[model samples]
Target: MREITTVGVIGLGTMGAGIVEVFAKAGLSVVGVDGTPELAERGRGFLEASTGRAVAKGRLSEEDQAAVLGRVTWSHRLTDLAGADLVVEAVPERMEIKRDIFTTLDGIVREDAILASNTSSLSLTEIAAATAQPQRVIGMHFFNPAPVLALVEVITTLLTDDEVTGAVRELAVRLGKKPVVVGDRAGFVANALLITYLARAIRMYETGHVSREDIDAAGKVGIGLPMGPLTLADLIGLDVVKEVCDVLYAATHEPSAAPPALLQQLVTVGRLGRKTGQGFYAYEKPGSGVVTDAPEAVGRPGAASSVAVVGTGDLATDLVDRLTAAGTTVTAVDDPGADTASLAGTPVVVLVGGPEGSCEDCGSGDCLIAEGVDPSDATACECCHGTAPEAWFGAVAESLDSRTVLVPTDEPSAWALLGRIDPEVQVVPVAVHRPTRSGSLVEVARQIDGDDGAVRSVDATFAAAGFVTLVTRDRAGLVVDALLYPHLNDAVRMLDSGYAGAADIDTAMTAGCGYPQGPFAMIDEIGADEVADGLTDMQTETGDPALSPSPLLVEHAVANRSFLG
Candidate 1:
């Protein structure tokens, strides 16, 4: 492995400047190069501002910050980088520009010097092809605000020398980064899965399936993400997101990788997210973090006229409290006296118990049976009797006159099954994983018979119950789980394939993307077997190979061992 002492960073943009700061702060001599002296000076200014903020936050002493800044030499000439042991190109996404710089550096730098690109989506092979020493070229991708973020994806092409990749990976670790090595592929690992998930969110917004706030809230509360996908895209800049999506789509030809038309339209109009003060949601000003609802944004749901709460459990109790707070006329019937007739006049009925137990007829003639419970089984009446699909369908069928029947459960399959029971029945499956205060609800639409009004109304009713309603089509995994399971499966596969260790991958996601938990920790909390089963079911339903459960996940699940263990 080659020793890395001095580093050269090309292009002095936001990413480039950050990369310069990272290397300098790591106690390395850094040369910041740009196309023009003005750009080089601007890059210096960014570094100064960034370090100044650190000083203000008491993270770095003024003397230490000065020492870090003093180590970086800014210049416009490419020849200044000739003495560097490694040159990381952080130029724009344009291929011509990146290749041109590589071609120049190929002649200027020493033959043994490693060349790397900090591209999020571009092909490493194509970029390496520009130089005569393709074997010496690899990818050293650093997340945005490189000094603050700890992830560094060390990507290697087929032609890239193993030693060069290893050297870069080791150097990244030495620079206080968590490095993960992957093949030279579009979007690498993080963006490959991330772009697909973002595109799905964008599609949901474009089709008016849900509001922006709900979409973001689902990510935050449902999966414990630090920010919603749309919000993150805005902070990242919509144009940049679109560019990465385009690159991934072109490379894989996957529908999920393609940017939605709405995103393009927003970009075309110069509404490039927080950078331009407008995207999915409007920001207070350009580059501002304070977000206000868009002008035509749909307001939160108002109080419902009447809603009936049936069954018992924590979910029921939470629902009752939220409904009452929303000023809805809550008709709670926890006793055996309350029956089908008790819920007859209520437009919305929230059933909390599983299939089995029967309640006295609320005057509707038939017993009020919980869905998915077996009424024939004498033990089914127990409060803990699991939810039975047949019982739920039967209950909903008896209450056919009710405007909406809300089934609160975390099982996506239950939602899919209930939605299939009767296409005409307004069966809205709700997944409330987080507490009511988190304001996250996964609302699955089992069937949309062109009646957008009815669907929106049901969504509003639930929203009024203090749940942030994330609407999605009737599918096995719905939105959050559908996207999340597959991504985690991929992470497991990466671990299994030795692309990266479990700890490194976890550190990369948590540090790089601000995720509350890495994939392994998530699987542990949700149960590895449960996650594997969810992914298997989704794959079986959608026939998407991407959703196929990983063998590693299956083995760990069967053995009951943690991924870390």
Candidate 2:
């Protein structure tokens, strides 16, 4: 009800200090309190260094920076916040620590002063109930480097007053942030989608389905994300990522939301991402982003001389064009029987689940339709798209005698089609996800049942043809789709629950996680019907309930509607 002037912030860690910087730079008096004088002083250093950087960057004048510094009164005592109109706790994410801070602030700050928790995933309802004035308690979650990132999740519990929510939203806008007001749900919006996706990536790596570099690269190169999930987890601190995973899992009871053992083990050891200098990737030192680990040696690009492409789809056509431009003799035919004589020596490419035109920002194993490379080959069609073509299979593979069969699919059914081939075929299960600004990602299964020579050729050929290539084990969804679809499902579920609108969720992801497009945008681009069918197929293959399509997704698919519209 009153104008907010003096603000008190508890805990002056990286996030806490950034919060202090945001408010102080906005020309408001701030009191930043930590547990000890030393920690409090450390918090001061964080604020001063941040402001000093801004001055150096010419973003902030030295005089204004000094004034900003003048407004902040750092302390180790809670009593000093008596005059503050609002107090925000940025303590450790543990419940007891936050509860203690809220209880202390309830007794210290004025009754009208709003109490907010800068928690990423803890239950705001439980945190609010710790104090007598639950109406004033809310969640003001700011992403890391708070002064930089524009997303602030303003969360409200049932007890949180509308005025409290409005004031926080107003302050967030004043501080130059695009705030998404969400209910008091675990992980709220951003982390709910983000952390679960990160957990899936971790599980993929843990199972040795894909390499660490490739996992990061698939999302970065294939999906056009700023950083891959594993890289983000490392940057955010694995411990923090794991904590949020626990919170989300506790709330949803979804296995995908739970932290993988590898993540927990890494945190147990002192490898807490860039902070400790050793996380998924080896960094130069603590707090450094420079990765010191050697990238896996890949086959030289453009190694293959001749290939026969026997598929129909935009992705396959793109591959044919790129490969042809790279000087590889490509024998591509829409009819499998049309080019059967030339398929003996050349590698045969069966493009499965191909859409003539798709959303520009499709991601991860997004196979929508089976292009009739073998128009009459029902087995290949039925295997990938779950529908039989007019003609049965085997015409495409009739000539290949022990030659490499490159079947790019969204699932492991590539092997199914190749298995039906009578001859001894070296099946290289290829996975495709296209949505990059510059290139696409072609992921292959590591040589288990697949031929090592064929795998090596694929890496060389796809990479040389201007695509990101990753070779991993023959997992159900390969690399990209394994982490992507479930995340989209989570977004759909979140939207269905009415926690946050689709536009707000999209903004949160784009602004907070640096994704090229949010989940809903991606779904609309890829087609809801196709995505739901893909999920259904993947769920049938894997039997993982996490892969099941959200009912909202199915509804949208059935109606041919966009999640955004």
Candidate 3:
């Protein structure tokens, strides 16, 4: 609750020095500590070089840089933190080391002084429990390159006081970083979700479902992430990522947090990251630019071709848009009525319909067909027979007979279609259910083709404006739909459990965690039937109870009476 003018930063490795530089640049006098004088001086020098780079880049004035640099005093003694109001521990992640540091600090700092940890992994509660003043302990998790990445996770232990929590939140904002408050669970919000997602990505890569390059490409292009997960792992230092995963897995007992074997082996081989000149990608010696081939010496698979989408709808449309923008191709489909087509002939199809309609039911102009009624808008179909899709799939199969069919529908339709399709046919189900952003479908197709003309192009439609694509082949949910469904369910669970509200959860995700939109809002944007279809597909695929459609979602879909509307 006290105003912070003087702060202490414990440990001055890369993150620590960055933290120190960040605080001092904000005009706070910082006491930066290390285990020894040599280490303390080294940490100071690291901060100087970083600020010097800023000065050279004209990002900071010389006078301001010097003043900022002047504010940090290096120390080898723990007691040097005695006069500071806030102490942020950026120590190595070993629990013994952190426990020792906190126990020592408990005797040195004032009772009202806030003791915070920059631990991205490890339990905030456990760290706090090590000290006599557990109420004063909290988490101020700064992202890597702490001076640059703008998000901070403000974590609280069960024993942490409300005033301390509020103070840390205010401090984060004052530092020009967006902060989201979370309980002291392992990995907090960002890492918990992010690491698990990244782990899944690795598993996907290992399983050969997608290549490393395409996996990264998928997150960057498919999920709207700034960088691919593998590239991020390299930059963060694979060893560090492993350590974080180990801590998280140990604490949460969540199997999802367990580090992949490939990640650990890379670290053990001394291929840490940019620091070691190699990782998922090799780096330029003495610099951070990545080299893609070093890991092939250890059996890394070469990249996969970025997925090439063939049509324009909610799914293929965006595929055309993203692929073209990414410089791939967008093939146009001339006629859905044309028979004798193979998936090799079409490769993919975007089946556009409302919830009540089937591919057979939808009108010739890409509209929904419900019973005997033909509707132009396919966005709001609410009919759910659980057997209608089978009837429709059979109709579609009979219509296209003997030729391979690639059906990209929402989860329910996909599941129904999957059951009806003959196993011998070549059917590839893709999940691409996110909306289109500002750009041309012509451009998105170019990106998908990626300069491989020999890669064969067939019928492709590039619908412009207000036409978005959802691309998932034969699953309960396609890529975007499946990704969003679990999170929406999690959001409902979070609100129902009193962890956060709709607005706060939305704010936390959009502002604090970098999601494009909050879960509930996205569901509304996507439509209830579409979401239900996705969940239905997922549950069918995994037979997992967790993937089942929520009663709330079903209610909304029924009341709306249309997914396309």
Q: What lDDT tens digits, residue by residue, belong to model 2 across residues 501-531?
A: 8999999998777788899999999789877
In model 3, what is the error at residue 42, expressed in angstroms?
2.5
Candidate 2: segments with Cα more than 4 A from true spot: 296-298, 308-317, 330-344, 347-425, 446-448
Question: How do the predictions measure up, each by TM-score?
Answer: 0.78, 0.86, 0.72
Question: Who is ahead in TM-score, 1 or 2?
Answer: 2
lDDT of 3 by residue, 54-130 (tens): 99999999999889988999999989999999999998888898988999998999988999999987888888999
Predict model 1's lDDT versus the native: 0.76
Model 1 stretches with alpha carbons more than 4 Å out = 159-163, 265-270, 292-349, 354-428, 435-439, 442-466, 470-478, 489-504, 527-565
For candidate 1, the per-residue lDDT at 141 reads 96
Q: Model 3: how far is 236 from its true place, Å?
A: 2.7
**lDDT, model 3:** 0.63
* Residue 430 accuracy (lDDT) in model 1: 63
Evaluated with TM-score, which candidate comes out highest?
2
Error of model 3, residue 262, in angstroms? 3.6
Question: For model 3, what is the alpha-carbon lDDT of residue 75?
Answer: 97
TM-score, candidate number 2: 0.86
Query: How many residue pairs in model 1 have overlapping backbones?
Result: 16
TM-score-wise, the better of 1 and 3 is 1
